[model samples]
Target chain A: MHRSYYTLIASLPHLPLHFELDRTPITRPRLNERLKLLEDADRDVIDQMSAFLVWDRQPLDRNDQEVIERYDNLMRTVSNPLVRALINTRINMRTIVSAVRRRKAGGSPPVGVGQWVDHIRRNWEHPEFRLAGRYAWIRPFQNLIDEGAAREAQRLLFSVNYRTWSRMAEHYAFSFEGLILYLARWEIIDRWTSQDANAGQQRFEKLISETLGEHANLY
Target chain B: MDESLLMILGWTGIYGATALGAVGSIIGCSRAGQAACGAMLDVESGYGRLVGLSALPSSQIIYGIVVTMTLRGNPLTAQSAPGLFAVGVLCGIALLFSAAFQGACCASAIHASKNKPEVFGLSAAPAAIVEGFAVFAFIFALVVAGGIPQ
Candidate 1:
C-alpha cells in the first residue's frame, strides 16, 4: 500500500554529503514545488515531520519543558513507524548533545526531562554516558567537546547524521521512505552550510566593529 | 472427461495466452513507463531512449499473440486439447513473468542512466536478458504447438 513517488524522487537533484558540500544543491522553494506532487495525506505527514525536525519550525526560545512537551505531542500524533524512528533518532542525538553541554557546564544530571533523562542520570559520571559501545562516535565527539572545539563537534554531529541517513536511504530506493531520507540528508546539508555562512558573517562583523572602534579612538 | 468440456478448456488456454500476456505487459509497461516519465523530468534530451526502454515490456504482448496463433492452429480434439492447454498456459505465464521483470530492469536502467548517461547501454543489459527469456518461451511454445495433433 506504500505509494512510490518515482517522478518526485527523480526530479530531486543528488545531494552531496554534508561535509563535502559548500551549499545546498536545491533551494527550499524548488524543493517545495517538487513536493507538491505528494498526496494530501503524505503532505500532512511531511508537515508533521517538519514540525519535529526542521530547525525554524519551532521557536528557539522555548524552555526544556516546552520542547519536551512538543516532542511528546509529535510522538503521540505521528503514527508512521519510519517517521517515528526518525524522530526518535533525532531526539536521542539532541539528548546526547544536551547531556554533553550540561556536563561541560558542571551541572548534575537533568530531571523532569523524560525517559532519556534516566540514561543521562545513570551514566552522568562516565565520559560517554556509557554509550561509547553503541555510539562509537561519542568518544571522539566527547573529546571534541572537552577540548572546546565547538565547530569541530558540530561537524562531527553533522557527519554522523549524514552517514546514518545515507545508510537508511540504501534500503528505500524509489519509495516514500527514500524520499524522506533524501529530505533528511538535505536538511542536514542545508543546516551545515547556513551555519558556516553565519560564522563567516559574524567574523566579518567583528573585524569591522574593531576597525570602527579604532577609528573612534583616533578621533 | 467430456470432449466438449476439453474443447472449452482448450479455448480458455488459447485466449488465456493473449489475455495473460496482455495483463503482464500492461503492468510491466505501466511500471517502466512511470519511471521513464520521471527520468524525462530530470534530464533534457534522450527522451526518445527513455520512452523506447519503457516500451520494452510491450514485446510480451506480441509474444502472447504469436503463442495464441500457434495454439489456435491446433484442432481442439481431446488428444490435442490437453497439449494446447498446457503449452498455452505455461507459455503465457513465462511471458508474463519475463515481461514484468524486464520492466523492472528497464526502470532501474532509466533511473541509473538519468544520473549517469554513460551507463545507459550497460544498464539495459539486464532488460535484454529478460527479453531473451520471453523469446525462449515464445519459441518453445511454437515448436511444441506444431507437434500437437492438428
Candidate 2:
C-alpha cells in the first residue's frame, strides 16, 4: 500500500510557476528539513532521484558516455515506474536538446548505444526529429535553438517541465508522488531563477570589461 | 427461513449498523486528521479550525449509533427481522460511504484552505454536502425503523 504523506506535503510552501517566481519559495535547509519526514525507503528513492534530476547536483563536465551509463544504471535499479518515467522524460529532453545543439554546430547525429541516440540518428534530417506531435514544444524549441536564442530555449524547456510536473502534482496530491512532483517543480523554479541571475551577472561583467578595455586604450 | 436464523440476521443488522458506521468514521477521521496535522505545520494560525474540520467525519459514528439504537428499539422476531436488516444494513452502507468520501472532501478543503485561508468556508461546501447525504440516510432509517412491526 502506498503511504500518504499529508503532513510532509502540507508543510511545503506553494510553488508558483517557474517564470512567475523571481526566487525559490522555500530555502534549501527548510526543504531538507521537511523532506526528513519521508520514510527511510522513500528517502532513499528521493536521494536517487535528486542525484539524477537535480541540476546543481550533476557535474557540469559529464560527457555523453558517462550520462548514458548513469541513465542505464538508474533505469536498471529504480523499480518505481513513475520515477523511471520521470528520469526517462528528463533524459529524453536533454538528448533532443543536445542533438539540436550538435546539429547547429554542423556535427553529424551521434551513433550511440542507447534507444534515444538511435532514434535521434534515424531522424537526423527531420526538423523536429519526428517528435513534434508527441511533444508540441519540440518545433518551437528547435526554432529557438536554431536562432541561437539560448535563454529563450532554456525558458521554453523549463516551462514545459513546469507544466508537466504541475499536472503530475495535481493527479497525485497528498501522496508520495505528489511530493516528488512538488520537488521537481521546485527544482525548475530554482534553476530558472539562478540562471536568470547568472545571465544578468554575465551581461554586467561583459559591459564592465568593454568599458575597462576602452579606458586602457585611452591610456 | 428459520426463526433463529432470522433473529441472528436481525441482530447482525443491529450491530453491523454501528460497527460499519464506526469503521467509516475511523477511516474518514484518520485521513482528514492526518491532512489537518500536515496543514498545521504550514500555517501559523487557524489550528482550531483545521482540527475541527478533521472531526467532521466523527458525525458518521454518531449517526451509526443512532441507527443502531433505533434498530434495537424492538425485540427481534421473524416478522420484523427482514425489515430491520434491510433498513439497518442499507443505511449503514450509505453512512459508511458518505463519511469516507466526506473525509476526502475535508482533506481537500484543508489543503485548499491552508494555502488560501479566505476559501476555508467555501472549500467545506463539498464535505457539508456529503454530510447531508448521511443525514438523509440517518433520518430515513429512523423513520423506517418505526414502521417495522414491534
Interface RMSD of each: 1.6, 1.1
- As for candidate 1, its interface RMSD to one decimal place is 1.6
Where is model 2 more than 4 Å wrong at Cα? A55-61, A111-115, A198-219
Candidate 1 on A51-90: residue-level lDDT in tens?
A: 7776533433346786678777887899877888888877
Best by DockQ: 2
Write the residue-wise lDDT of candidate 2 on B1-150 in tens digits: 988999988988887789889888988898899889988888999999999999999998899999999899878889989888888888889888988888888988998998899999999999999999999999999998999986
lDDT of model 1 at position B3: 87
TM-score per model over all chains: 0.86, 0.88
- After best superposition, candidate 1 residue B146: deviation in angstroms? 3.8
**What local lDDT does model 1 show for residue B67?**
89
Lowest-sum lDDT 10-residue window in model 2 chain A: A53-62
**CAPRI band of model 2?**
medium
- Name every residue pair that clashes in candidate 2: A7-B38
